[model samples]
Target: MDYGIWNVIELLGALGFFIYGMKVMSEGIQKAAGDNLRSILGTMTSNRYTGVLTGFLITAIVQSSSATTVMTVSFVNAGLISLVESAGVMMGANIGTTITGWLVSLIGFKMKISAYALPLIAVAMPLMFSKKPNLKNWSEFMIGFALLFLGLEALKEAVPEIQKSPELLSFLTQFNDPGILTRLMFVGVGTILTIVVQSSSAAMAVTIVLCAQGLPIEIGTAMILGENIGTTITAELAALVGNVHAKRSAKIHSLFNIIGVTWMVIMLPYVLDLLHYIWPAPETGDPNKFTLALFHTTFNFMNVMLLIWFVPSIVKLATRLVKSKGDEDEEFSLTNINYDAPLTAEVSILSAQKESIKFAEITKLMFTNLKELLNEQKQDTRDKLKAKISKLEVRTDEIEERIADYLVRVSEQQLSIESSVKVRSILSIAHDLERIADIILRMSKDIERGNKQKSIFSEKQNKNIKEIFGLVDLSIEQMITNLNGVYGKVDISGAIETEMAINALKTKMRKQHLKSTEKKEYDVQSGIIYRDLFFAAEKIGDHVINVSEAVRGDFGKDDEDM
Candidate 1:
């Protein structure tokens, strides 16, 4: 009866504390286990079922389904996983999130763990300041674990006892009427609560505390269902900056949860009776939150069981709902990465690697465009090719800048030895790819200028150019294969052979060009263009070798190439 504005402030403060603890704990664990998480997501999602299990394991480890979903969206955006696989993972994440409810119920309500909060902080202090990254990360996790229980304890003290406050009890009871409308209204309440908090786990914590403080079990159950639907908002928001596939993956998460919740709401009364029959509410000590936790787990587990078989159908619906732009060019956009959230060093480096591959692929396209420009006889077609090459060149510059920025951010984090090497290697590879694009654009410009000035090449000179173009294509193809292959597993012997052939061809072209110029076989301007073109192709070959070297983790060691 004495509840006031300060009580509301205390309640809000406790909620913020709980949410912050969840954030810190989740991030700490994720940063510590990032590589393992990447490995799991990459290797285990071969099918829908495996993806679900992968998602559940990851969510359970990190203790937040939102983090798992966001990571899933990132992977989909990177083209690392398929839509059906993502659907399975999202389903698994739903079941995994119920772990938090059970934790709060079994530990927070049944035990006085908050009594150890201060002692836990004291123990973590030394590790928090450790020079080792792993130690420091785990220390943060311990501190977060302590703070979560402390926040829960504060929440218990902040909420007024519903029994003593007859007025408040009367207000809450109005929504506890045994009707479908009552359940639906409470579900809406839970949904709004989760959306406002941006954390289903935190919302579940609040719901558990309320139930413990005399709120009805049925009302809490409805809210838990709403929280399931609410949690999908994280994935949707995460996919906002992603590509079409990422959006579709997120759509499947929303569709799955909404459909599950729809069926559950209709079955709410029967489910409640069954739950009560199975684990009747206790009359004593901190109202039985176990039933609420049980409902949370069973609902999600059953939902996954019912929906796993329909992953393909879910993917189809999502794809139809979120259509790709008709003219979307994967190379022209940074589809593999986003800056919306802070990613661990491992995840960040992986994103940069994928983007760098796209950067290399773009240079290959520019080379093809240059060849097209050289062959086009019509003035209009040549102009168009020139414009296209110029556009791609500009885009390559932008892509390189973005990848550099992303890598720099990744480098700022505490990285393992391998990840640090990868960051540098990706940076070097991106630089070389952008340089190749520059060379291609310059060659295109030279050809355009020659055409404008009526500086026609001799048959022999054209043949040499065609031959060099073919060699360069071979080199670029090898570079891409190296980029796509596992790091440090590349066979640069093929790249070396191609590079040698290119160099030998460039030397031969130079010798023939000198003889032609000496004999006045063509104008000095035409001879100069031929030499420049061959030299540009040779330079691209050099950079392609550099890319292969970087892929093999042998970058910057060879002065001749570097």
Candidate 2:
């Protein structure tokens, strides 16, 4: 009866502090191991099982299932990981998040960790002032860690004692009845609480604390199940603006948890009995905290075990649920790089690198179409091909703009020297790829015009132009390899050789065309078309070499030669 609005504000403030501390700690860890985290996520999630473990480990370390799921969704959006693999990771993330409940129960509630919070801050302050970047990051982690426990302590004090608050207890007792409807109601309460907090870990802590304060364990278990369902909302929110695949991954996460919760509700009594047999609550102290922690862990582990075999089915169901619109739907979109998610410079750079590679591949496809347009003799086919090439040119413009914007955004984040340099290189590569697409589109249009004007190249001239196209194609291939980072070093020698070959071929062909024109073998109109094609091919080769140079970090070096 005596509870005031200020009490509610104080409680909310304490919860905010806890969430902020978790965020700060998660970010510190991400920054410290950003590169390594990228490598692990890139290489380790090759299969469903490994993917699950990767998810588990990342969530465990970050202590935020929401972060893990969001990262997983982003990777799926980026095409860095498959939907099936992402499902495994999501499952593992659910299990990993249970660690927080155990932590809160075993340490935050049991020990006087808050008393040492200031001392930990005192120790971290000196390291924060250190010149070393790693030290600074570690100091930040320690500070967050201290703040987390301090907030936890404050939260414990802020939550009113339910026994002393008869009116509040009576209100809560209405939903504590032992019935299926009551369990569902409690589950809904848990889900809503987690959605409101946007953190299952925080929700779990609140649930555990309430149970410790004499809330029924059965109701708390229902809340735990609801938290499981609610936690997926974070990933769903992240994937809303993402691609179809990302949406499917998020859907799969939701389905997995929801289905698991549904089954657990049916078998609630049996499951709780099993959990209690394995890890019984204390007789004197708050048994509910221990019971809830064990229940949380057991529920996730069981869900993963039950659903791991159904991953393929889940993937198929998700795919069917979220259908792609069509080819236009596949147009270049930045799904993987969520600006709202906690971003590290290393991860942002990786996303940019992948986008750059995709940019190169798109340009290569445009060049292939250009080559097709060059040889097609049928007017209808040529027109259609021209339209396709023109569309691709527009798409390339979009890709370039998106990639550049992504890189610029990434550069705005705190980046290391190396990451900053890489961002610049990627931006340059995107620009060159865009130009290459434009040149190919121009070449296609030239062919269209030549066909319309009845100024076709002679048999011999067409053969020579095809040869130049061949050389340009090889140069594009080399540029793609450079972008893939397969060479491990700045090996621009092949690019340089291809450039020299393109130049020599262009000069020889131009001289031959002039001689042919002088002999009246080709008319002035035909000569102009042939020269335009030759110049365009040579320009494409130049752009390819520029991309290669950017990949090799030699963007401005030897500008005269380029």
Best by TM-score: 2
Tell me the tens digit of each residue's lDDT in model 2 across 1-562.
5768999999999899888888777756766775566566664458889888888887887788887788778767766678888898898889999998988888898889878889999999999778777777778788888888888888888787887888878877775546787788889999999999988988998888888776878899999999999988888888888888889999999999999999998888888888778877656777888888988888899899999999999999988988998865543454246767654555556667766776787788888888888788887888888888888788778778877777777778665444556777787788888888888888787777787788878899989988998999899898888886621256889989999999999999989988998899988888898999998899989989988877776652335423
lDDT (tens digit, per residue) of candidate 1 on 131-166:
777888788888888888888888888877888888
lDDT of 2: 0.81
TM-score of candidate 2 versus the correct structure, residues matched by position: 0.86
Q: Which regions of candidate 1 are displaced past 4 Å?
A: 44-47, 74-82, 129-131, 170-177, 241-246, 276-288, 323-332, 335-338, 342-349, 372-385, 403-429, 450-471, 474-512, 519-526, 545-562
TM-score of each: 0.83, 0.86
Worst 10 residues of 2 by lDDT: 553-562
Query: TM-score of predicted model 1?
Result: 0.83
